[model samples]
Structures are given as C-alpha cells and as structure tokens.
Target: MKILIKNGMLVTAERTFAADIFVEDGKISRIENPGTLSVSAEKTIDATGLLIFPGGIDPHVHMHLPTPAGFSSDDFYSGSRAALAGGTTTLIDFVTPHRGEPLKEALEKRKAEAASCLTDYAFHMSPVEWRQHLPEEIKACITEEGIPSFKVYMAYKDSIGLEDDALQKVFYAVAEAGGMVTAHCELGDEIEQLRRDYVQNGQTTPEYHPLSRPAELEAGAVEKAIAMAARANCPFYIVHVSAAGSLEFIRQAQQRKQPVFAESCPHYLLLDDSRYKGSFEQTAPYVLSPPLRKKSDNRALWQALSDGTIQSMGTDHCPFMMEQKRNGLHDFRKIANGAGSVEHRLTLLYTYGVLQNKISLNRFVELISTRPAKIFGLYPQKGALLPGADADIVIWNPEKEKTISAQNHMMHCDTDIYEGFKTTGAPEYVLSSGHVVVENGTWKGKAEPGRFLRRKL
Candidate 1:
C-alpha cells in the first residue's frame, strides 16, 4: 500500500521542517518538499496544520502480566490498541521466566501471548535466578534469539528478585556477551522490614505502601546496583528511577564516564506522595512499585530531564482493575502495584512538558521516541522519519483539547490515574507499517498482528 502525507511539519530530535512523506511497502520511501514529486497513492492525507512525528516508543510496559491479583487488566490486543490511539507504535515488554524455567522457553511463551498485538513489539528477557547453565542461556538469548537486553529485579525478593551473587553472575555473563542489563532498583530487605514494622503497629492501610518503600531505600538500591554493575564491567540501565537521591547516583556514574542510562516514568514526574493521602479506593491506583516520591523529587526529575541526566520517559503501563485492588483493602501489601497510563502518556507529556515550557518540542520527541529507540537498539529503523525507516507515523493536532476519562479511553483497565486531566494536543491520525490504524481519534484498521522485532545489540 502507498500513503502520502502532505504539507505537515516534520519533527525530529533536532529540527522541524515542512515536508511531505511518502510511504511504500511499510517503509518510508521519500521525504520531499511540498509537491516536489507528483506521486499517486491509495490514500492521501492533507496534514497542512498538523505536526508529523515518528510514532512514540514505550520501552517499559507490562501487558497481560500475572500477579498475585490474577492478571493485569489489559492484554496485548487492548494494550496495543490504546498505545496506537495515544500515538505509540512500538513497545518493549519484559519476558519474566518462571522459577527453574529456561529463558528460551519464557521467550517463546511471551511471543505467543503477544501474537494479538496490533503494533510492533520486542522483549527484554529477565534472568530471575542464576543457575550453573544460566550463563550459556544468556549468551544464546543475545547471539541466537536477538535479545540484546536482560532485566534484573532488586525488589520482590521472595519471588522474582535476585540476590547479590546471582545478580553479579547475570551481569558478568551479559557483559561478556556485549548485552546491556536493566534493573528494577529497590532495597527489598529494608522495604520488607518496614512493611513488617507497619503491620505490627496496626498501620496496615494503603498509605503504608509508599511508607514502606521510600525514596531513601530506592536511592540505596541504586547505589548498590551501580557498584555491582561497575565491578562486572557491564552497561547498566536503571528503570523507573523515582527519587532525587537516585538521580545523584546516576549523575555520578555518568561523570565517571560509565555507560549507565536511567529512565523516569510520567507518574514519578507528574504525581507525588500526596495521592496516597486519599481514601483506600482513591489511593490504591497509585500504589506502583518504587512508589511516587515528594514534590521536591518531581522537580528534581524535571531538572534532570532538562539537563540530559535522564535519557527517556516510559509509562511502565501495568494496571489492574478496582476489584483486584480491593484484595488489599485491609493489608495494603496485597494491593496490585500499577496504574494505567499507556493511553495518556503522550497527551500528558505534551500538556505538561511542552505547553508548560518545561521542555521543547524536539526534547519531547527525543524523550518519548528517539532516545528509547537508540538505547534499545531500534534506532533509525523504528524511531526516525528518514527514508528506509518503518512507516510508523503520527499526525498531531496541537490545538485540540479533551478531558481524559476511563469511559472514553481505549485501554481495558477500569480506572485512569490522570482522569479529569485536560490536554491541548492529541493524535489526529496514526499509521503502523503503512496501515492507517487510527484516523481522527477513531480506530479504522484491521486486527492484523504486529511483527516481533528481533533487535540487534
């Protein structure tokens, strides 16, 4: 199929210019001045007043995740639909292996589950336990399976988290194979002790969730993880960096010229601990891991983003229904720890980051799309609008305004953390692989599944 998008202002990480984009066979075939080439197409879009951007890439999300509270609300189909409507075309989800299971088996299982996705996707293989043969498995995943990144958990110690010895082994193996390691940084033992203290004192409400996992503990874990990765000589990535102190650790590493990258989510930058002061029902939705920090922390994160200390912004879009959250009404610890924002990430960033003058249009595109693609080895192919790139595009209407509500959202979740928030911009149209998936805020494409991107290191 051929698609021509004419007269739109094309945005990149460095510049924005007026041009017409021509897409053929799911790839960008040409980018020319207005009316430079008289080419015919199956469809033509007049984007005279819109901003053209390469589709957003969310590098951290968990769809169809299994937890103690059954499963997350949105599966691959619904999650991908919401992502497309919100202007995201590619997602990278974690493939967590079960206890004693091989990484290869886990990868196959996740691929099968994501077959219903409507946009391109990739996986970051998780090494939960270190065994004698696990080093070989990590090598195979990088060399044979085309997975160049691995995830390690410093929290959730009772289940998926790894001990220092195990984490060191995984880091060494990944480093040897020229792969990067991403970590969920939190001091599990300290958090678990704090939770015990809270429960023992009869403070078992949802408010205790954030109290047990404080910013100081997160900073401590970040420091420890950096030390371990440095010893192993591995490239490290810290996911969901929420605290101001954690940023210092990352900054120091970068000052030393370490290959350490960090990402902060929208919730960490926009919301704060005050959300936990509401009633249980109101507060449970914000009970995500590495819980929201102080408003001061939010300000520091914004500064870090502006100063280039933080490289990208991801949604960490894992959500559970209200009924699932009700399981922890009394204990707080059992409350599912995630919120839905895959459908609101772009709009919220635009309204808060760009409109508020916190960041520039080029910085916005870099944070949401370009940096993620480059760091995760999908650059130029998935994050650029140049010729020979995937024809995943978004036509943004910068003047449109709308209020966000779960009733009008495309995600299958039961609630929205940013409900009632208004946005001044939205996607006028979205294209995936040269197919018009969303037009004028409505879904118009078929249910054709997205391809599994085998990334390079």
Candidate 2:
C-alpha cells in the first residue's frame, strides 16, 4: 500500500523540514512539497500539526530473559506491544547463554520464542560461556547469526560475567571481525564482599543495593576494561554507566583517542540512590549493576549525554514482577533485579529532558534513534525517515499530558515503575515498515510483522 503523510514537520538527526512523506510498499518513496509532486495513494494521512521523526530505537532491552527470578516479565509479543506504544519501532534485545547451554542454542531458543514480535528487531550476542571454541562461536554469530555486537559482563558472577582474560579473548575476536564489544563494568568480587559484609551486619535492606556496589568498584572495572580494550585495539562500549568516576574514566579514554564509548540510562540520569524507599517493587526495580549514584553523578550523566561523551540512550528494560522483586528481600541477594520502562522511555525523555531544556529535540532523536543505529550498524535502513529507508516512523504529540500506568501497559507485566509519573509527550501514531500499527493509543497490527535484522558488515 502507498500512503502520504501530509503537512508534518520531518525531523532527522541533522535537519528538519516541512514536507509530505510518501511511503510505498513499506518504504519511504519521497519527501516533498504537498502539491509539488503528483502521486496517488491508497491511504492519506492529514498530519495537520505534528512532528514526524524516525521511530525510536531502543538498543538495550531484556525481554523473555531467563533469570533466577522466574522470567523477565515481558516476552516478545508483550515487549513489542510496549515498545510500539512508546514510539519505538526497533528494539535490540540480548540473547545470552544460560547455565550449561551453548550460546548458539540459547539464541535459537530465543528466536523461536519471539516468533511473534510486531516490530522490527535485532539481537546482540551476550557471551557467558567463554570457552576454547568461544572465538569461533563469536565469528559464527557475526557471520551467520546476523549479530555484530557481543556483550561481556564483569559482574553477575558465574551467570554471565567473564573474567578479565575471557573478556580479552572475546574482545580480540570481535575486534578482528570488525564488530563491537560492550561490557557491563562492575567488580563482582567487590560487590560480593560488600554484600557479605552488609548481610553480616544485618543490613540487608533494599537500600543497601547501592551500598553493596559502590562507585569505586564500577570505576575500577571501567579503568581495567578500558585499558584492556585499548591493548586489544577493540571498539568498546560501556553499558549503563552510573557513577561520576566511571564517566570520568570513559572521558579520559575518549580523550586519549581510544575507540571507546559509553551509554547511560534514564534511571541513572534522572534518579538517584537516595530515592530508594525500601519498597521491593521500587527498590529492587532500580537494583541494576552500577547502581544509582548520588545527585551529583546524575547531573554529570546528563552533561556526558549532552556533550556527546555518551553516544546513545538505552532502556535496559528488564522487568521482574512485584512478587519476584520482593522474594528474599530481607536477604537482598535473592531480591530479583530490573524494572519495566520500555513503554515510557521516549515520552519521558521528550517531556523531562527535551521540553524542560536539558537537551534539544533533535538531540533527543539522535540519542534515542540515529546514534544507536549508526554505532551498532543498523543505520540508513532502520534509524532514519529518508527516501529509500524503511517506513519506520512515529508521529508524536508533544503537548499531550498523561500519567503512566501499567493498567494500560501492554508488556504483560503486572507493574510499571513509572506509574503516576506525569509526562507531556506521547506517541499518537506509529508506522512500522509502512503499516500503521498504533494510532491514538490503540494497537492496529499483526503479531508477526516484525523480522530479525542482521547487521551489515
């Protein structure tokens, strides 16, 4: 089908224009004056007063993820629902190895499970089983599995974390393949030691989550990882950096002209450790690695994001329901980690950051959409709204005020962490590959429209 979007301001990473976007066969065919071009469309949209931007791309999210806390609250079907409702057209989730499972097997299993996504998506290989055959497996993932990015964690202990040597091996392999290696930089041994001390002192509350994983541990890991990446001459991306010290490490690395970059999440940018109130749902929800930092660090994160030290924004949307989050809360170690915010990322950024003048609207588009596509190698096709690009677009109402509630959330989760948070911007119309999947808060598409995308080498 052919569709014409009339009279909308087209916004891209670098420019904006008042033009009509013509989409044919799920691809943008033209962007021109309303009447200067003559074309017939099966459908026409009168975007009388709206800003049209490339669809948001959430580069980091965890859906249908298997963890000790039962499972990640959202599977593909529900996660895509939440993503589309929030104006994100593409999501790159992780497919990491579980205990005793080959990485390839884990990836294939996830592929089978997510056979019904409604948005375009991709996977980043998370390497947990770092073995003798790990290099070949990484090569196979890039050459055959369509994943050009691999993740290694310095935290998470035996579950997913790799030792420094293992991390170096993965880095060397990915670097040789011209792929990116992202690391979760937090010292596991230090955290475990702190946890032992905390529990020994009977200080096992949810608030201790941050105290257990201090800034120095994160910075130490960051410094070590950066040095290792430099030695291997590999491109590195630090994931969800939180502390001021860690940011400084990244800044110094970039200053030294290392192929090093980092990303910070909204939780780190907008929220702080002092906000933890002991409620498992609230406390455990925010209990991610490189835990929330002090208010001073929050501002630093924003500055990093603004100055381009941080290349992109990612949700890290890993949700565990209320019950799971509360499990063993008195012990803190067994309290499930992660929260759901995939559905609110775009709107929150627009309302709080862009509208409030923390960043420019165009920068918002770049941070959330264009930059991710470019860095992770999904650009041109999935990140922009230009002619010959995929018809992945979002028509957002920048003035709409709405309270976020899981009552209407589509992620199949029982709760939303952003509940009661008021926001001014929300996605009103969404198109994925030329199909209008969401219009006016209602979903309007099939379950399997989404396809897994392989990165271009």
| Best-performing candidate as measured by TM-score | 1
Error of 1 at 37 (Å): 2.0
* Model 1: per-residue Cα lDDT at residue 108: 94
Tell me the tens digit of each residue's lDDT in model 2 across 5-40: 888888888987788989998899998976665799
Off by over 4 Å in 1: none
State every prediction's TM-score relative to the real structure: 0.99, 0.96
lDDT of 1 by residue, 258-365 (tens): 999999999998999999897988899889998988999999999998889999999899989999999899888989889889888889999999999888999999
> Which residue runs does candidate 2 get wrong by more than 4 Å?
279-282
Q: Return the clash pairs for model 1, or none.
A: none
